[model samples]
Target: MLYIIDILGTIAFAISGALVAFDKRMDVFGIFIIAFVTAVGGGTLRDLLIGHTPVGWMNDLTYTYVIIVSTIFAIGFRSKLNYLRTSLLLFDAIGIGLYTLIGLEKGVELHLHPILCIALGTMTACFGGVIRDILCNEIPVVFRRETIYATCCILGGVMYFALGVLPLDHNIVFLASGTIIIATRLLAVRFKIALPNIYRD
Candidate 1:
């Protein structure tokens, strides 16, 4: 189940990256590069921080293949995807939700503190997009006050631990947390929800 979620998350991030690359009118190689980094950037960072050597995609080629395939799909169907208007944002939300769960699970496996686990989850969920945005010369959405991005991941991570105390199955708890993250993001976007700006208007 975790493996499936990881693959799906990779696909989502890759597609999201491809869309961004397309918007920037990048070349094929640039599209693939952006897609690859956005797919595994967060996971790579998490692995390095946790001392998981060689990172994850380096150990397994499945993630690489998934990113390649996803990038191609997004590019090939760029017109159709662009018609949706919100496809990139949708995929990004899905990626973050799935990656958050994967990170939280890894932290638990290593017996890390709950707080650290949540931090790992947030990093796993947001850093990929951060890298993508930085490379694309845009401020990352996670750092913007106009959108509730990392907050969704943090709340989801907290919910994961909160649900852990229940007698529910682990998978159920996992799905619930993921759903919370995804739904929160969609709702936030729909409602124009945002954090208060610190600077004067």
Candidate 2:
């Protein structure tokens, strides 16, 4: 189940990265590079921080294959992809939720402190996009005054840990966490909500 979620998240993030590349009029190779980094950057960072050798995609060729396939599909459907804005947001939200949970689980497995686990989860969910934006020379949306992005991931991670103490099924916990993250993001966008800017004061 976790594997499936991770694959889905990778696909979504890859698509998003490809879209940005396309928007920038990048070449095919550039698009693929952006897609790969956006899909795996966060997880790789988390693994490195936790001392997980070989990282994730380094150990799993399937993840590499998935990102490649996703990039090809995105490129092939470029003309028709303009209508995918809403779909992209949905996929991104799902990715963020799944990544957050997976990061938390990995941190716990490493015997890290709970707070560190939550931090890792948020990083796992958000840092990929941060890298993507940086590479594309744009300020990361996650750091801007947009709707809650990383905050939603952090909240969902906390919820996941709290529910994990119960006798609930693991799938149930995943669903709950994913749902909360997605709903929070959607509602924030719908209402034009945003966190206060630190520089404002």
Candidate 3:
């Protein structure tokens, strides 16, 4: 189940990255680069911070293959997908949720503090999009005047930790966390909810 979630998250991120590239009218090589970075950027950062060598994607070729296949699919379906903004948001929300839980799980496995684990989870879920936006020459949506993005990951991570103490199945914890994050994001979008921004007068 964890493996399935990881693959789905990777594919979602890859598609989002490819979409960004397509929007920018980038070349094929550029599209692949964007897709690869978006798929692995967050996980790679988490691994590096946790002192895991070779990172996640570098240690496993399956991750690389998944990203490649995902990129191809995104490119092939670009025309059809152009009209599905909501579907793309759903995929992105799922990716964020899964990545958050995966990072938190890894941190817990390493015996890290819960607070630190939550931070790691948030970073793992958000930094990929940050890198993708930077490469695409756009301000990251997470940092802009938009609905809560990283906040959803943070809240989900906290919920996961809180639920971990319960006599619940591990999979249930993950599902709950993912569901909370995705639902929050969707609701935020639906209601145009947003956090207050700091601005210089």
**lDDT on C-alpha atoms for all candidate structures:** 0.87, 0.88, 0.88
Model 1: runs farther than 4 Å from truth?
A: 1-5, 84-89
Model 2 whole-model lDDT (C-alpha atoms) = 0.88
Q: Rank by lDDT, descending?
A: 2, 3, 1
For every candidate in turn, the CA RMSD to the true structure comes to 2.0, 1.9, 1.9
**lDDT accuracy of residue 74 in candidate 2:** 96
Extract clashing residue pairs from model 1: none
Candidate 3 Cα deviation (angstroms), residue 110: 1.8
Give lDDT tens digits, candidate 1, residues 67-132.
888888888888898675576667667878988988888999999999999999999888988999
Worst 10 residues of 3 by lDDT: 192-201
lDDT of 3: 0.88
Error of 3 at 164 (Å): 2.5
The estimated TM-scores of all candidates read 0.89, 0.91, 0.91
Superior by lDDT: candidate 1 or candidate 2: 2
